[model samples]
Target: MKTRAITGFFFVVVMLGSFFAGAAVYSIFFGLLAIVCLQEFYGLLKKSGSSPNVATGLINGAYTYAAFAALFHWDVYPEAQTIHKLVFLLVPAMLAVFVQELYRNTDKPFQNIAYTFLGIIFTIVPFSFFHALGFVTNTGFSAHIPMGFLLMLWANDTGAYLVGRQFGRAKLFERHSPKKTWEGFIGGIIISAIAGYVLSIYFKELEWKQWVSMAIIISVIGTLGDLVESMFKRSINVKDSGGILPGHGGLLDRFDGLLLAAPMVFTYLYFIFN
Candidate 1:
């Protein structure tokens, strides 16, 4: 527990620094993290008795980093249409992987390649939304965007854990995540909403209604993200993705909720404001 707490603290500091630093810096930091996560994911795939080409893994990671950099640093697509184009890229890439699998004739080739792609998409795409959000600035609001989103996520997670430990009775999803309770989930939403309401006051561009809506979205979707990662772990028969961080397990373990939450928050901000 002490190790986990220390690691968690270190993670919070680094994330806070990255959030305040600006888009390019944050993108590079997270890009490296994405690469690490992809490597860990490939390890899991290998453990499943399927070997994805290491070069393919590198390609996937590069594509992900490029997609994010383009979305944020360049106007590759209209602001509203970026994600759709990103999705389009996936089809051709996955088709290429499928063709490669046919030639390899390895154990469970298709399923392994398919799930590996899914994991990457699931973990990386939503974060691109945050990267894009950093670009949607009203001058002074630049620093506020990432920090607000990070705080809201932190608040939600903290709220759920505290409340669940105290008064959790009914389970939320027993098979996917046994410790989560419906009560704690609701508590998390409420707490996060409160935090969002406070943040809205500072972010001049966003209305209170929009902020609260985002909070609700984050709480619910973030929980689902955790469950999704849990599902992956269960499938691979692992406790954590890696032991890179003493308490946090790996980049994936620490950011699972953010992976889902960031996209929802970004979409809400984009559609409502733009």
Candidate 2:
């Protein structure tokens, strides 16, 4: 428990620092995080007796970097314009995997290659939305948005845990996640709403309605993200992705909620404000 607390503290500090540091810094940090997470993801697949090659790993890592770069570099190039380039680049990258698998003549090569590709797209692609959101400028207002999202998410998770421990009676989703309860889920939503109200005062750019809307989205979607990761772990019969962090499990586990929440938040911001 002590180790978990210490590690969680350090993780929170670094995460908070990076978040406040601006788009460029956050992009770099999240980019590296995506790479490490992809690596860990492939490792998990391998441990499950699925073979993902080094070449596949490198290509997937490159894909993740490219996605973030495209989103962050939106000022220099339009998103639609860069997306065309992404599709062009991905063709050969994916083909290389099939070509390698065919050359090696491995059993179930196509299945392995497909799964590797899916893992990269599913796990890392959504995070690019975060980079996109960071780059969307409302001057000083943009700076506060990511922090607001983080605080709301953290509050939801923390509130759920505390409430669930104290007064959880009815299970939320027993098969996917046994510990989660309906009471805790409602508590998380309440806490997130409060955090959103508090942040709206300082954000200035967003109205109270927008802030509340965002908070509700984050709480619900973030919980879905956590449940998704829980499902993944259950499918593989593992308790954690990796023991890289004492209590957090793996990079994937730590960021799973963010991964799921980011895209949804980004979409909301874009549609509502843009």
Candidate 3:
């Protein structure tokens, strides 16, 4: 318990530090974070008898993140031709996954290819969207949105845990995550909405409604994200994703909610908020 608390404290400090350290640190931190998470994902697949193309996936995952980082850094709009071309570059990288599989003599060639791509899609793409969150506005890389989003997410997680341990009875989704309860889910949403309201008072970049909407998305989608990761782990017959974070399991476990929530939050901020 002490170890978990200690690791969690340092983890939060480093994460918040990365955000306030400037745009470069934020981009680099998440860019590298995507790569590390991809590796852990591939490791899990490998344990489940799927030989994912780790090298190719890692290289391409790094490339994918860097591409998004570049796009976000430059504030490139979708209508720009460079944006189209930059996105076009991913086609070849994705195709390379199939080509790399041709050389592997494993019987599960298609399975390997699928897992490789899944690792990228699961781990890299959402992080790319998260990276864009900091630069979603043309305001030149403000941390308000990203930081607010995280605060609300943490609020939801903490609220759910506390409430669920006390009053949780009805299962939320017994198939994927048995410990979760609808009571906890509602508790999370309420706490997250409160957190959003508080954030609106300080981070005036977004109105209270928008912040609350983001909180709800993070709570609902983020919980789904956790379930998805739990499903992945259960499929592999493993308890935790990894032991990198000591008691926190792994980077993938820690950021599973962020994985799914980041993209959804980014979409809301990009299309609706912007």
Candidate 4:
């Protein structure tokens, strides 16, 4: 518990720092995070006897993330226009994996290629949407939505963990996650709503109702995201994704909720802002 708490503290600090620092730091930090998570995911696949083209996949992942980052900054930075043009090359870069696989002479060439791209789709695409969330509005980069999103997510996680441990009786999903309970799920929503109410007092970007709505979205959908990731790990018969974090499992374990929830929250904010 001590290790987990200490690691969680630093994780929150670095995450909040990334948000407050500026767009460059935020972009770079998450860009690297996406790459690292992608690598971890590919590593998991390889352990399952599936050969993923790690080199091509990482290069394409990096290129894809950089392109998306540049596109997100198109409004604020002029040079972003040039960097944004790199997005057009994304298709060719992805296809290069297929060509590279052909020479490997492996029988499962398509399977290899599929998993290679799957890594990018599973990891990079959501992160790209997350990166876009920081630039959702035309006015400028605002951390209110993204930061609030994290606050509510953390709130739900805390609430569920505490409440589920105490009052949880009915299992939420016994197959993927046995500890989760319907009671905990409801508890998470309530606590996250309270967190939203508090956030409205400080961040005036969204109305209180909107804030609470986002909280519900995060609580419900983020839980689903957690379940999905759990399912993935269970399929592979692994206890944790990796041991990168001492108490925490891996990058994927830490950010699993964000994987699915980021895109949904970004869509919500995009419509609200635009």
Candidate 5:
């Protein structure tokens, strides 16, 4: 517990600092995070006997994040057509992965292609939505959108852990996660809603209702994201995703909820504001 607390404190400081620092810090922070997560994911696949092309996948994952950054944030690619041109650079880059896999002539060549691309699709695509949250209004940047998501997500996690430990009786999903409880899930939603209410007071980009809605989405969908990652680890017969964070598992373990929830929240904001 002491190790977890210590590691978690620094983790929160760095994350919050990245948010307050500005867009450049935020981009570089998540960009490197995506790369590390993709590497960790591919590392898991390699341990599972699926030799994914780690280097090529990392390149594509970085490229994909770059493409999303260009599409959503960069002013140089202003037009819709320009966005396509900027983003399509990934197509050839992905194809290069396939060609390189063929030349390697390793066993299960197609499986390598599939898992390699899967790592990028799983890790990079979802993180790219962070860029969308900033420019939801078609102009200017608001860290609140992305940061709000993180705040609510943290609230849900803390709530669930505390509540679930105390009164958790029924298993939420015993197969993938034996400790998750429906009671804890409910508590997480309530806590996230309260966090949203508080956030609405400080960040008035949206109404209190909108922020609370985001909390519900995070509590529900983000829990699923955690389960999905647990399922991945269970399938691979591993305990933690990596040891980069000491007590906190790995990049993938820490950011699993964000991986799935960011895109949904961004889509919700896009429809709401656009």
Candidate 6:
């Protein structure tokens, strides 16, 4: 218990610091996070009797993140064509994973290669969307954009845990996650909506209606993200994703809410802005 609290404290501190410190810091932090998460994902696959080409996956993810961050954070590419050129590197890098599989001589050659790409899609792509959140409004990379999204996510988690413990009876998904309950899910939505209202008052970047919609998205989609990760763990018969965070399980466990939420939220904000 003490270890969990200690680890959580430091985690929150680093989280806030990376968020507010500026775009460069946020990019560097999440870029590294993307790599670490890819490794851990491949670790899970390995335990399940699959040998994903982690090296190729990691390298590809790193460059993919770098290119996206360059385009968004630094505004390095003035032209959309140039950005496409940068992203085109992923084409060959992805193929390289298949090529590398030949030398690995794994019995499940296609499966290994497929898992390699899956790891990148599941872990890195969502994180890249999260990185884009910092610049969602073209406001020159403030924490407000991403922070608003994260606050709702955190609210949902807290509310769900608290309410689920006290009043949980019916199962939300007995197969993937036994602890979650419908009562808790509703509780999370109510609390997250309240949090979104509070955030709208102070942030002012998004109006009340927008914030409410965001809260709804976060509450529903974010919970799905959690369940999906839980499903992943259940498949591998693992308790936690990794032991890197002590009480937090692993980076993947802690940030699982962002996996599906990030991409959806990004799409929402994009549609709203455009």
TM-score of each: 0.84, 0.89, 0.94, 0.97, 0.95, 0.95
TM-score of 6: 0.95
In terms of lDDT, model 1 sits at 0.75
lDDT of 1 at 184: 93
Across 103-126, the per-residue lDDT of candidate 3 in tens digits comes to: 889998998888888999999999
* Cα misplacement distance, residue 77 of candidate 1 (Å): 16
Model with the higher TM-score, candidate 3 or 4: 4
Give candidate 6's error at residue 141 in angstroms.
1.1
Candidate 4 per-residue lDDT, tens place, 133-203, comes to 78886677887778888899999999999999999999999999999999999999999999999999998
For each of the candidates, give the backbone clash count.
0, 0, 0, 0, 0, 0
Badly placed stretches (over 4 Å) of model 4 are none
lDDT of 2 by residue, 1-274 (tens): 9988999999889988988776667778877777777777787777878887655756766675675566455554444554636646766776777777877656888778877776777566766676566655534225578778888888899899999999999999999999999999999999998999999998876888888888899989999999998897788788888888887788888888887888999888887766
Model 4, CA-based lDDT: 0.90
Off by over 4 Å in 3: 76-86
- When 2 and 3 are scored with TM-score, the better candidate is 3
Residues 66-151 of candidate 5: C-alpha lDDT, one tens digit per residue: 87776655553445556647677878998999789768968799999999988988889888886668778666667887888889
How displaced is residue 150 in candidate 3, in Å? Answer: 1.2
Best by lDDT: 4
Clashing pairs in 3: none
- State candidate 1's TM-score: 0.84
lDDT of 3: 0.89
Clashing pairs in 5: none
Point to the candidate with the largest TM-score.
4
Q: How do the candidates rank by lDDT, highest first?
A: 4, 3, 6, 5, 2, 1
CA lDDT for candidate 2: 0.78
